[model samples]
Target: MSEEANQIVQINSSEFSWNKKDGVFHFDGAPALLFWDNAFKIFLSTIMEISGPDASNAVFETTGFRMGLLVNDYYQNRFTIEEVIKKYSEIYSSAGWGNVTITSLYKY
Candidate 1:
């Protein structure tokens, strides 16, 4: 397999720790994996400010699986594994303003 063959990858996540402010979901664990979109990024930031340093994230696995489902469910749809990977890579890269990272993509 060549690198060019696979296009799309998967959403990447960083380590996030669970935090607790007087016993709350303040991401105080240890920064296991954090993923955020527009809404999520805001949420993460807010939480961080409110609580403390508990969680860290880069991106999500699937911003939304609806599209992927559609393609997969389509009877006529037939994408090679590599093709699907490519598609993910394109989206991940395209999501610049979104500011997302590339994670492991599914082989199938």
Candidate 2:
């Protein structure tokens, strides 16, 4: 990973408490609702190994589906995947991960 990718990974990892044994992410020390943006980042990290033409599509679909179950469903559809992507793009950019994008999340 590049330094920026490493930084993103670090930021994302610090946001949650992980249960390595169970492969779970917890908020406030509990398995509570994760924000949609956070869920998107987590799912995006998993597909870092993916590449080629459909990479963005893969990231979009996978992140959307996971967010639907982990965050959106619990909040009753307050936001969309597009919104999450746009919001996080700015966040990642400002955090020195400017290369990170909805499309680039999986492509790299």
Candidate 3:
């Protein structure tokens, strides 16, 4: 949302859903997932609404990473970035969307 912040904010859509029973999140076709249990409550934008595991799919382009470089800030506030990616990839394991894929990530 801010060039200086390097945060590309996006809105949630139908692809993002909630699994109330499991307390996990599914986004953009990703599987039910959990991260830090409850670090992210709600990620809001004009078009998107995402939570926890679903939040991982929201990263369209470089956000804080880019902002950090711009401001000469090298530290990643959250260490789970890599872990989150791994988990997402793991859930995707050889399973294709089978034609139901988001052509582009929403960013504003």
Candidate 4:
């Protein structure tokens, strides 16, 4: 891992919130579903850019699977904080955000 990869990427957390009590995530003061459309649109654009038009769907599916793995491992105590960071770094690197680090993870 490079030094640049250790820096966290900044996002506006104010756009999203989570209710720990109910285990629910909200976006823009509403349920996450309301925000998914726009979020997916942005994500699809990046997917197309990275994987090209034809492979975007497959790439998206694979990416989702990898993310699930990371989350599952985290919840199952299969990875330490450093391990989780490394795994996420690999994911972001593959997704064309190699130089960026993620500062937070929201349930939504």
TM-score: which candidate is best?
4
Worst 10 residues of 4 by lDDT: 5-14
lDDT of 1 by residue, 7-56 (tens): 33233321122333322221212122334567777986776676565433
lDDT string, candidate 3, 1-108, tens digits: 223433222232224445555444554434445444234433334224443334644553446566557433322343354533443443333223222323344435
TM-score for every candidate vs. truth?
A: 0.28, 0.26, 0.19, 0.31
Predicted model with the maximum lDDT:
4
Select the stronger candidate by TM-score from 2 and 4.
Answer: 4
Candidate 3 wrong stretches, greater than 4 Å: 1-14, 32-108
Residue 34 of model 2: what lDDT?
39
Can you write out model 4's per-residue Cα lDDT over 20-46, one digit (the tens) per residue? 555565443445433355686897898
Cα misplacement distance, residue 96 of candidate 3 (Å): 24
lDDT of each: 0.43, 0.52, 0.39, 0.58
- Report the C-alpha lDDT of model 2 over 24-81, residue by residue, as the tens digit: 5554233634356767687666666456438967777887799768754543364565
State the lDDT at 103 in candidate 1.
Answer: 67
